[model samples]
Target: MVFLPSLPAHMQRRAPSRRLGVWLWALALCLCLFGEGAPAWAADGEGDITLSSRYWIDASGVQSVDEVAAQPAGTLVEMDGFRSFSLGSSALWMRLDLPRLDPSQRWFLLLSAAAFTNEVDLYQRGADGGWIRQRAGDHLPVAQWDHPDQTPVFAIDAKVQGPVWLRVMNSPTPTSPRLQLLTENSLQTKRYWTFLMVGGYLGFGLLVLFLGWVHARLYGDRAFVAYCFYVAFMLGFQAAFTGIGGLFFWDQSARWNDMAPAVFMLWLTASGIWFVREVCAVSRHHRGVDRFVIAWSVFGLLYPLLYVNLQTPAAFAVLNLYGLLSVLLSVALCLWTWRLGEAYSGWLVLGFLPVHLGYPFPALRSAGVLPDSWAMQYAVLIGSAIEIPLLLYILHRRAKDFNENRARLRALESTDPLTGLTIPLVLTLRLRDALRRSRRYGHRCGMVLVELANHAEIVDREGREAGDRALVVAASRLSAVVRDVDTVCRVSDTRFAMLIEGPQRPEQLKLLAQHVVARGLERVPTLPVELTLRFRLVSATLPESGDSSEAANDDERLMERLHRALDRLASEPRRVVLHLPVRMPAGA
Candidate 1:
């Protein structure tokens, strides 16, 4: 097994900090996992705070105010539900307003929602009377509330200087809904810790990906490395949505802002499916599904970049829907791998369960139904943070076993177990390669056929094992006498063939043959081994008149005839002379 040396370009392009990068990421992830809670909520403005609960009501009492508030009025263009009153829209709407009249002060609105009758919209009104859109700079979608906080927050623009309205509304629907807006300054000291935790998670996630590339180059496996990329994307998404990206790498805000959730969910889903497919051989059963997943993932990945001009909420909705599709696909893949008895399936399902569980939060929050922040989506990232590495370790063990089995098969194919010589297939391939070189370099080559004389007699005298041992001993002696480029193989049960390359005279050949035969006879010192090695020399240069392949076939036939003649010679218990055609023998 000859290894090809690496090209100079590969050596030059090697990463210097690849391993260190991975370690750094691991350290960061560890810190995040054990860290304290998120940052404390603070109002840009100091003012009075109000606490209130709203209800979603329609013709009947089936829908809650929270449910109605959660969905966009446009989407609720035609919804039907039970409400106490005949508020006959598809959903209901309501709000908790901190109403006043001051023009000299800035304010922050922080609230915590308990539950929604269905789901509702929670927003903070600006002094200009417009809702304050939650935009985490360029890295995240434009959100209007504290969806990232899993609580409610409205960061009024620097221009909203004055008394502003804080309102939560539910679209009119058949079902009456209820939700609470609790808390004033949710962004407090806790935010400092949340920033640290989420930032570390993002940093470490990227580091893992960098290390995975290094490990793959060194060890020649890519599945684990691919999983690392998935983890990295999820962490990046968390960081962007949580505003940590804006806080530190503000320059990266634009790139991370829209791309965070879309790319994260796309890459994660695709990588997860690919990992499972490889583990379970899912392609064999449902290849089309895999193709669909890949196509959808690519589309999901491109959606953010392609639709940058669209509103953040709208774009986020589309992205969330894609994520939902990904989760469903992952679930399907898990089932398939499970049914296939895949060892990694259990861990994969466990690792991905949180991601799926967290999938609905984005869409729910985006539609104004779930009064939470984008930060809650990071729960999926946190879950994957713990699951990916453990699952990769499991895959690593399985891969090791698989590679070992393959190596064993390759060994069996190349070597003769009994005599420890090259098998016919291996010998033939080597001979073909050597013949090409010999012809190209104008060198001489020859072959010797050795046979055990009256080998049945040895089996009758001792046992088949003894006969086998005699053959092995003879093979070892021949191998010892041949050049490094030479090959010896058991071409038949009673016969062996040796290949010799490079220039050699007939006298040199005859002497070598006699020496090989003598060594075989000496193997059984007590009794006559009754073995004879026949010499059949064929040069690399054949007659130009004959076709190349046909001449080779004819040469083998000639060898067969010569062996028969030699058997006749040996039958008489003495050697005899055999002359060739007009072609001059080696050394003349």
Candidate 2:
């Protein structure tokens, strides 16, 4: 007789009808003892065959199939459900009774927690009454396994009968053994969806990584470069953890096949911390936190060296602990920098929120605190898929804002703040370039100096605001009338200058002067309708080759000569425009 564990308190509670409740209790007991203990059938099964309850034994260490089979039946412990084991060098042996199956169909036994087990050897009775052995697991290259997959899968013999034995050797990570029996069709469907989802995730991650690299190169931003490294390591971690690396990337190398997951995980964490530090600009705000983060990153990078050498349960525990601490530290840094008013820090918090919520499932599982579940398998994958693209967008925005601010600063240096026109210094440089071109290329370039003669009169009548508006209007008019190659400058309080590149006749200079005067005299909209702007204009062609003027190559002297001509024109109220000869100096 088999004794079972006690039922729940709710099930044992007294019912209103005592006889009926007694009968129900008897039925439940019979189902637990007899019905659930029956052998599972693989013949004509359309889906998974359930083997939740089976017999298992702790073999303690390495044992041969013959030794395990020779053990007395009393040594086997009956397990009514799945079991989890602490990671160590110990091994476990399970007995599964499979009935005869259809000869035409193929079947497979899947070990769901394949990554946590180093080796799994399956034994079956042959027709000659000898035990036949098969092998699958991470200890050997995936290509050499009985059935190559991300998990341990062994082919089931349709002609075999009676009990089959399975021995599992645990690695340095926690192990929860789940067994599922599948037909070929069912296995194909499972593989289809699994490959599709993992493939989609890997493709998306690569695209985002490429974009991050482009941003790093285009902007020359340390933050973007850090993000690229973070993403690359993230992809590697996912590949290794999901067993894709063993199956496709490095299938032939058994050493790297065993070490890839831990190494990539460590590098992923280190690069993530470094990325956070860069994107948040944490060093500029808090030196203490920044230094702590740097130290943690360095530790994360170097800890793998010790872990690879030791390969102990304690070392695996340390890896999980470090991952948990890194998550907490990253979140705290984001919040701290955000409160200090860092623009990108707020985005960093949002971008990291999904991964933060998903990290605990895998972290606890790795620490041996949680059972294998869907959350432990794919939670981080889903969260990171959302996070990577979001973070890239934040980086893009950061780059764009930085570029705009830089352009604004440069504009403030070279242009007048109110009128949005070049200042005297910028105008002086351009004028020098134009004079050199005129002498070298034998081309004539002209300068027009216009004074707002009624500026003070408007200020006295309508206040200084009106005078400022008039200057703005004049600047706009001057800008609209010139070609794009010309430079317009507000040289003084009541004077403006224009440098026009040319191979022009005198007629064009006169025409431009007339246009400047006409636009200035238009009716004022921002001022009193009766008040109109008055202008005094003087134009001169710069000296070309063969000209005798000493000021031909001197931009300052040429500008001084133009000013004197404008002053002379200002004295004659009857004259609206004057053209100075190229060979004449200011007072000549």
Tell me the tens digit of each residue's lDDT in model 2 across 1-588: 111223334433621235434533553453344332112333354333334335445546767778877889887776654446673777778887775677688888877655566888888888899988888777888889878888888888887778888888777886766676778876777677668988999999999999999998999899998899899998898888777888889888767778888898899999999999998898998788789889999998999899989998889889988898888788777767766767567667667766776677777776677766545766677778878987998899889999889888999999998899999999999988887777677788888999999999999999999999999998999999999999999999989999988776678999999999899889989888889889888888877446645555677777888898888888889998998865645344
Tens-place lDDT per residue, model 1, 346-391, is 4455545444544565545544554343233354555556555545
Q: After the best TM-score superposition of candidate 2, give how far the Cα of residue 273 lies from its true spot, in angstroms.
A: 0.5
Q: Which 10-residue span in candidate 2 carries the lowest summed lDDT?
A: 1-10
Candidate 1: where is the Cα deviation over 4 Å? Answer: 1-200, 211-232, 248-259, 274-281, 287-325, 341-378, 390-485, 500-588
lDDT of each: 0.50, 0.79
Clashing pairs in 2: none
TM-score of 1: 0.49
The prediction achieving the highest TM-score against the true structure is: 2
